[model samples]
Target: MAEFSDYIVYVDESGDHSLTSIDPDFPVFSLSFCIVKKDDYTRAVVPSVQALKFKYWGHDAVVLHEHEIRKSKGDFTWLLTDRARRKEFYEDLNQIMVDAPITIIASVIDKLKLTARYPRPWNPYELALHFCMERLLMFLTSMGQQGKRVHVVFECRGKVEDAELELTFRRIVGGANQWGWVSRDFSVMEFEPKFAKKSVNSTGLQLADLTARPIAIKTLRPEQPNRAYDVILTKLGQIKEFP
Candidate 1:
């Protein structure tokens, strides 16, 4: 077995899994996994992001969230009214994404076409989770870290929903089916998934959330100019979206 680092993969979602709430123009669901070594996350990623927040607001309590930054809402009210400052702060955060020591693996589901093509399609969240986990394991394998285990941490929706998500992830890890059989052999992720709300102060989840929207935007609006996303496109895995 290959050696592996103790790592944590944080997954944050952009867009919804609800077929009913599908936006005709942007009907895509995206889940992004930001993988980092446990030690590096604490010694590097966390403090770096903290510095960025402090640089802007001079406060440690402020968190970096993509949607909130874009709309300039919530704790980011100061940024809302100041276009120049917001633009500068946003650029610095993107630099953090580039310089951070991590890997990005994501799955984007084209919900509008998925439901149309299949009368009974697979659940979007579950589908994305399956593919993302596979890619993460593959990444470990490629690095010759087959023996190192990775755990997935998801942003919570609620107690009930979070429990359901955890169960599904455990089942997947158990290799309950054909795909599971492959994961079982790889043996990279064997731990039960963790679900903590974003308010729990997880820098990893914050990073994942920051990256998820740019991915959704690129997938939903290919024609639009998105230089920020272009900067991180190289990190995206090769998993294709479902039809």
Candidate 2:
């Protein structure tokens, strides 16, 4: 089984709420979690990523669209599609998941629908990102209370143009101590954006993307129900209950 330790966790997001800023559509956001094992951080994450540099051209390496995976070879194709290969990959991944002790919490909002029901004070993207981060931090706190030290690293959402997103994230982290998301005297560090982008292309981010896609699709097809949530939850197998 994988073992836990003091590790660096990386995160990234996908999709935007620009078009929906006025008349909201689907406000989808993703949070990917990846951790570098204390002992094998360099070998496991850094080198593997460096090897994939040749394949980055003309492909959506970050978001990883399904169509592109269907056209690739080696790691990308095996990990993204090809069910048999994915099953084997997960079997191996179980060890890493247990050892590195990682989790990703992604939350999305169907903005057009949500605003129509209950309006929010901030932009949908900003609100959804903060909400997801809050839940993620809450989960981390609960894990820490169980005696785990987690160092969270996030890919900055570029230089935030919207002051609300900046303000909200600052407030959330600053007030974490007051809100019990952090212990009475614990400190959390945020890392630079590119560090997360350089992390391994693990299933965590792909799974988060999977979770967000259906929500985004549902905004246009209100008649359709989101089944990706259940599909991904089943695949992850660790998330028994979602908040």
Global lDDT scores for all candidate models: 0.79, 0.43
Off by over 4 Å in 2: 1-7, 19-67, 70-101, 119-121, 145-151, 160-167, 176-231, 235-243
Top lDDT prediction, candidate number: 1
The TM-score leader among the candidates is: 1
Q: Which ten residues in a row have the lowest lDDT in candidate 1?
A: 178-187
lDDT (tens digit, per residue) of candidate 2 on 1-243: 122334545444445655346433434443434433444555553333333333444333454433344345543665655677666544443333334333445544444454566544345555554555555555555545324444455433445543454565556555542322343322343311232332455433433333445434533454776444334443231221111
> Would you estimate the TM-scores of all the predictions?
0.90, 0.49
Residues 129-203 of candidate 1 have per-residue lDDT tens digits of: 888877887776776665555667888899888888888887776775543334545345355477887778788
- Assess the local accuracy of residue 198 in candidate 1 as a C-alpha lDDT between 0 and 100: 72
Clashing pairs in 2: 2-99, 3-99
Q: 210 in model 2: Cα distance from truth in Å? A: 6.4
Give Cα distance to truth, residue 240, candidate 2, Å: 13
